[model samples]
Target: MEVIIATFFYARVSTVEQSLDHQVSQANDAGFEIDEVIADHGVSGVQHILKDRPEGKRLFDKLRHGDHLVVRWVDRLGRNYEDVTDVIRHFIRSGVTIHTVINKMTFDGVTTDPVQQAVRDALIGFLAATAQAQTEANKIAQRAGIEAAKRNPKKYPGRKPSFDRLKTELVRNLINKGLGTSAVAKEVGLTRQAVLRIRDDPQGVEAALQRWDM
Candidate 1:
């Protein structure tokens, strides 16, 4: 194992809307001894790669040889597969190690063997592609729900909840993405009970949103 000179944790979060609660703690819990915590607040990983984010740019410039970059997932590096692969490759070439906390995936730029290199590169490609696919699928689901909600908006007759259409959309989308009630609720800033209500009666919630012109 190569000696790590430093470890940095980076994440992109819409902190104004959501919370940035566990990113650094998660990395530490994953056994990465972080020397610094760098977060690109109000940035969407789905919309911008690490190079475009303010703090992300700093991260790229600050990393040095024998340094390790720890993230919750490989998706934090870029917005799409191409960008993700490119960024990972660039850092690896610069002798920086990239590791994901989820699977404990590590791409340390220390290997000379062709087989080890191939395996690591392939894993990076696969994870990046998977993250992109998930993002696309969530968008598709949200769009479909919106279109459906627009078709017949006359089912609701009660008071509207505190969540607006955007929050409702996020709730439904995350639920469709297979996130549990607590996760979806926490993500969209809704109560678990409210998320459960939306999950059990998506059409009702959509109709309520329409009623309020949300």
Candidate 2:
């Protein structure tokens, strides 16, 4: 009997307007016959773990033996080194084959030779650590930028709002309809934190928009 393996594509984005479909397109361009596309939109990989996220949880539950998991990179799996490695190892042990589109890396649990296994495990660790380090560097740069903006609000003025006027009004209307932050965020294609900001200070956001003529 031949074992039929299913192919899955996993993708995520941290904010609205970020291209979640690009990863799927990349996988398609690579010629993988994707059975399903599991996506977590408007969710930050840096702040949410795979098990904790809504769509991430679905991916974990749906993956099975002989399944192929494709991601744009390892960072889509988790936020830090340990989390990334642990998730990959868990799936590999369950007989899942992991592939990356960016680096063309593959990880599997079929090796019996100690030397080859050790080499593969070491490479996974190194790549995961590198992704974690990049996340940290980005956070540091963001903080520095925020501090600089605070020093001169007239010069920096912070980042423009991710949502336009129509979406901003939709967010407020959702809140007025008693929708929770997470629900509003999911509905409006914004992050939960962004929705909370809008809920907590509607006037402030409106004032900023007016000042910027947005």
Candidate 3:
């Protein structure tokens, strides 16, 4: 049998400006020799399912029996409680040892002690449920705010876009010239997805640009 020992790192951030390097460095400092890292940037854990995201789905396909999956924290694995438990359980059942760099937590299926197993399972379940519930509450509040905004569009001021007019024009020009999103981000010094979003919705970009001046 292949010694199937590997450490997989998962890093996630809710915004394009957040750095994955901080999480990577933390894991490395904790003495885990990470073989590969999978990240989903500018993606919300509470709203997006692990299996639904492009990078998140890619990670699901890479894990195998005997592989070790590591994360900065339990929250890194999921946005909600149910998702955290579901993903962890799915991998644990497949013989993957889930490790968290913070507090050096480990969850695996090999525990033989009934009491310890029960305690661990209970904690996992409780935490998962809490996370999911919190996520739902956030979603509800967000929906209410959005509905209110729709009712009075002038009352809700959205997030300000960080880029300047020069960057915006360059980003759009790059796409119009047939450049890929990644390339545009590289040239304009913005995240790849941000460039794509700006290209797709010029009106939104214009709105954001207006905020930059204020």
Candidate 4:
């Protein structure tokens, strides 16, 4: 008999003092043999989507049918409600099972019972929808904070951009030189869609440059 193997993947945003080691340790303690881990440093869950993120895009290529994906939480999947649902549905259709470590919740699509399948799907949808709503609330809070900073420019100091100015310049240069968004992004260490947005909006590039003190 062939061994039916399921894979687990961990993702995390690298902080100054925290690393993927913590997440890895947690997974190991949970008895999961981690097949791979894709991480992005200085990346915000609120700012990027699954396929749009650097490490997240790799998931599409790496995950196989019958494979299980484990996340720390639904928030790790996305920052928006719709985006998270869309991503989960995509994986479900692709025959990938999703498991959340925080809640120990699992969503699988292989059930034969129609009613049971419907119930499972409905639950999955509910969780994904809730994740999206929370993400939107976070966005609202972020926007409110930005507006507050504008209201009290002296008292509310804005944050510094995580990416480097030189990197942004490189992304712009590569894009202007007729490289594809994905190509330029790979060349300059950014998301493909981010490079596309910069290419499409010169003002956006300007703002990003300013944010990075370029």
> Over all chains combined, what TM-score does candidate 1 have?
0.68
Q: Give the alpha-carbon lDDT of every model.
A: 0.83, 0.87, 0.82, 0.75
Once fitted onto the true fold, the runs of candidate 2 whose alpha carbons sit more than 4 angstroms away are 1-3, 156-214
Q: Is candidate 1 or candidate 3 better by lDDT?
A: 1
Best-to-worst lDDT order: 2, 1, 3, 4
Query: Pairing residues by index, what is the TM-score of model 2?
Result: 0.71
Off by over 4 Å in 4: 1-6, 14-18, 143-154, 157-214
User: Which one wins by TM-score: 1 or 2?
Assistant: 2
In candidate 1 the C-alpha lDDT for residue 142 amounts to 86
Off by over 4 Å in 3: 133-214
Candidates by TM-score, descending order? 2, 1, 3, 4
Looking at candidate 4, the ten consecutive residues that score lowest on lDDT are 153-162
Tens digit of lDDT per residue, candidate 2, span 1-214? 8877799988887777668777788878877778998888878887888988889988778898999999999999887888899999999999999999886788999998999999999999999999899999999999998888878756666678777678888999999999989999999999988888888888978866765667
Residues 1-214 of candidate 3: C-alpha lDDT, one tens digit per residue: 5576778898887776777998899989999999998998888887788888768887778888889988887777687777888898898888889888888988998988989888888878876786677778888999998988867645665665657788888887888899989888988899877887788888988876665563
Better model by TM-score, 1 or 4? 1
Best by TM-score: 2
**Model 4 deviation from native, Cα RMSD in Å:** 12.4
lDDT of 4 by residue, 54-79 (tens): 88888888887889998877778886
**Alpha carbon RMSD to native, model 1:** 15.0
